[model samples]
Target: MRSIAFLSADFLANPWPEYARFRAERPVWWADEIRMFCVFRHKDIRTCLTSTDYTVEYPFRVSRQVFGETLLDLDGPRHQRLRRPLAGLLLGQRDNIGFRAAAEDRARTAVAALRPDTELDMVRGPARTVPLTATATFLGIPPERHDWLLHTVEYLVSHLDGSSGDFARASALRAELEEYLLRLISTGAPARSMLGEVHSWVRDGRITAAEAVGLATLTLAAGFETSTGLISNALHCLARHPGHAAGAASDTGRLRSFLKETLRWEPPQHDTVRFARRDTTLAGVPVPAGSALKLVLASGNRDAEVFDHAEEFRPDRSTHGSLTFGHGSHSCLGTHIALDVAEAFIGALLARFPGLRAVDDPMPPITGSTFRRPQALRMWLGPKGES
Candidate 1:
């Protein structure tokens, strides 16, 4: 027994190996330092994620050091009530087709702008640009404000490691965002777009001003980052497995399988945290109420018991679904939209640049947070036959 942290680098860089080891020995082990039960097996993870006894601690007292107490931290009825209007905005079928198509168009335009033989930063290019542009455009935010919004999201995400200065900065940004929303609400901005619709929700009391800002900020913060990561990670996976990419590029069936397998292989949110709502037992291990449990979603996705040759990225492989987006009532609201954007981006990229290859200099640095992603990914592009 090593008696060290379970899912540290030994796991993040190549989790399947560690998960196989842990799931075989201590599927449910308590981290004394973190004061929570760490579960690595697929079945145990699924049980914890889907269980009502566990709850998302809002404003994540710990994560508030970075993300603040937003909807991501809320739970139960309050979380549901707060999420209703936003859910309506994201899930409503009213104009979803138009919006979805518009998003794809925006992605296509971004892809078309790529210059030949250039090392494009996926984070700054299509990954960050497409979603931010599409979401901001949909919300009717002024084109000029996109830069400031992206900067804000970048600064906020940087503060995730409990930096005091970062929190102070995020606090200021949060206030500025709230004030901005309040003024928009006070002036009764004409309902010009979805962002305006969010203000309308506030004005009509469907959501509070704070809630509205949180929703908006969350949209800005989470929307682009995760959506971009999904495409980038999927591409990285395919590039590593040329056969899988080729398979998916030719067949929609293969594409669907690729999506599932990619998610299982490298989910955006590598781990999800929870502060137990009350004393609870997870698969027989006792977790004290309020203890922070790190459910290794990425680790769980590759559990050998649930997924054969879990370490391998095989698009055609069949098995239970991954908990990438999450499970239970508090699952991601924008998951479908995220999937849509990802599929569109990958679909377009493969169709346009079948010879896409990763750049030696721009391979993104693997991160060490609950969310697993490269800091940036740059790829070499060439004519169809060049690579």
Candidate 2:
């Protein structure tokens, strides 16, 4: 058995093979580079997400270190207090005339902006733009400030890969965001959006103004990566399996299954970390309390023990327990909206454009260790059979 340098250039560039090897040989390996126990099996990864022995909140969680005491950095009651009401409001907007319509409108606008005659980078065009714009709409951000929101999220996410200048830029960005969001909060609630809800929280004294800013920032940054990844990833899946393209576009059921398979095969948020609440054992390896464990969700999604013939991309495969979205309490709050965005955008792309495909057969490779997505997907959008 070989030791896994989980963050090595080789692994980060392409990790599927290492994930398979690690799951088979050392399901509970300790990664010396990051100084944490890496859990590769499906069950163990699920435990890291859902079990009482492990918690997403602790002094050492990376998110906490990055964004400080934001809503994403909280645990249990405090987390729920801020999230539950907001989640309820968000859910209410899930219906057609509400949140779903907002998502659809944003997605359609993004799709309509694409010019098929010339090559277009889908990731830069629709993938990133739709989510950020949709999120701005949802948060009631003003039209003038939309560009700031997009650029800020770009840097906020870039910090995860330790990109140069991102940390300092993040600091400056956070201060600017504080001023902007606080002003938004002061202007009073707008309709029934996330920003409005946070404003009410500040007014009601349920949370401080600074806490409200943290919460807004978290929500903005959170939805950006997930939806962007899903859109681009779904496109890649359809392109790779051209046989399934027309059928999925015409049929809603096929499209849903297609998205499900894409989520499992190439999840955007590849891995996440959890800290032990108490002394716990994962895959028979002892893990002391407070020890950090890296849950390889991408690996778990492909665990053969969990999903039969998992290595292959079977669009029809049952993806019931897939960890494409993190499981349990920490599951994505914007999941419903994200799905709406993907279905609308992908649906529009297929139905209106007909045979949509990558300009190149392979497309750009999915990149990033944390938020895995094609940085660029230059596409040729035309009638069926053009590609």
* True lDDT of residue 20, candidate 1: 67
Judged by TM-score, which candidate is best? 2
RMSD in angstroms, all models?
A: 3.0, 2.5
Q: Rate residue 28 of model 2 by lDDT.
A: 94
Name the lDDT value of residue 111 in candidate 2.
72
TM-score of 1: 0.88
C-alpha lDDT (0 to 100) for residue 371 of candidate 1: 60
Q: Candidate 1 lDDT, tens digit per residue, 213-316? A: 67776776677767767777787787677777888887766886787777778787777777677888876788887777778788788877777888887778
lDDT (Cα, 0-100) at 51 in candidate 2: 88
Model 1, residue 162: displacement in angstroms? Answer: 5.7
In candidate 2 the C-alpha lDDT for residue 282 amounts to 83
Give candidate 1's error at residue 225 in angstroms: 2.2
